[model samples]
Target: MLSRNQWLAVVLIGLLVVSQLPGPMVHSVSSRPAHLLSTLLTPLSQWMLSAGNRATRRPDLLQRREPGEDAVRQLRAAREEIRRLQRRIEEYERIRHRFGEQLEAFDYVHAAVTRWSGDPANPWLEINRGRRHGVAEGDVVVNYRDLVGRVVDVGPGTATVRLITHPQSRLEVRVQPDTADEPARHHLVMVDAVPRRGRFEAMVEVDADAPIEQGDIAFLHVGEHRAGRGWPEHAYGFDVGMVTRIEPDQERLPLLRKRIVIEPFRDLPRLSNVTVFVRREYERPDDN
Candidate 1:
């Protein structure tokens, strides 16, 4: 028997009280009303949100990309590819110019290092080339002019290389005085691996005034001792590393020789790619 306005006020008050009830009670008591209200207000809510976004100058990111934007992205990618190729070409050119005569005797197989193994003191690299790609067990792996390691195990699709830093590795190397006017006096030394240390150590007796500096390079000595080794004859003069530190050999009573440390130009553990030297069948002594 209440007026129409009084009935509306009562209903609104009831709705406000129901909204404050516990979620479970409100859900059970007003499921139909909630569904109908949501359905009626959804379009209006969406329109208000869109209008706000437009007012803020925010574009809809879910929309399809424009044709011009796609073209620009493709063009940027193509330019990057060209730059990468150019840099690779420059590297090859530098290698050819530096080791022209030495590289002519053998062919190189490119390989990507896929994994590393062994303890830190005696680590090894696994490359993605195997017998199928002419990579033999004794094949020498190198990064440009730096001697990396020797292949020890080979599978059909992969090969493992024992790095030069292995505890058992030893190499014959030579260092020359830093004098340019005088004849190059080669200081021959046998470098041995130091356990747990990723460097080579050698003892050489130098005159007090000899110009052996820290930055002097150590080159692999390829003579009668290494003549029969599995290494390619062309690898005779590759760089081993630079002289990092020199200290007096205390173990020696007279202290006549100094112990020098040689570190590779590149970090062996961080190598991503290497080249394998594959010997060709039948080589002419006079070739190149």
Candidate 2:
């Protein structure tokens, strides 16, 4: 356990003691004791030297092993983060391509829906765009294939929109009857109003003798429902939905307001991207 310098001093003391011994006594001691000392000291000296070498080399040797493990872990984490970001970029590219073709037909702003109201009773969605993106409070929002909702509130960087499933949503809708070769405009009707108790559906009150069926296609905003019977009339029209479930109320047969439920053309909750028209499009002369 002695240090290197201490071991050297011990060796010097043994040599001094040997020199003081009488000549014949030294020779007699060397015959047995010297051999014993050689046997003991050889391996002990080698082991001590080996331990000292390891101690002196430990600082650099330990530095490489521990830091090597940490570096590997950090590299693996950085790779995973890069993969995640690449996936997000691919998603944005797909969304851009899908929204491009339909947007060409109209003057509109695109937005990504960032949030949703889980309540079917008061359904809504939030878009990561606002007035700064040219989206006004009353702008119409639609997926490429069909209507989604209307912008209700606007912020600097975000906007709140009311989806059609909301209890208070009342966009005018028109249906094409089953057996009618009649022009699309002739069959237009204001959707009968009802309390949105559950599920997404529009109750259309039609005549009992009318040829309206369960599979008829429907349109929204085609004709102008109400500027509240007092406000200025605005022009807005778009393809809305289709008649999926029809129930004729026997109690209202004489009244000719038999109710039918219209399901939207596409499932609204599944839509991720939508275009919001900045102003009511007055392009359709018939809508006037």
lDDT of 1 by residue, 94-159 (tens): 556666666775679988666565366768877777767777768788988778889986765677
Model 1 C-alpha lDDT versus the unseen true structure: 0.64
Q: Which stretches in model 1 have alpha-carbon errors above 4 Å?
A: 1-105, 177-183, 198-211, 224-230, 281-288
What is candidate 2's local distance difference test score?
Answer: 0.58
TM-scores, one per candidate? 0.56, 0.52
Cα lDDT tens digits for candidate 2, 93-149: 544454444334346778766555657777776676765566666667888746777
TM-score of candidate 1 to 2 decimals: 0.56
Clashing pairs in 2: none
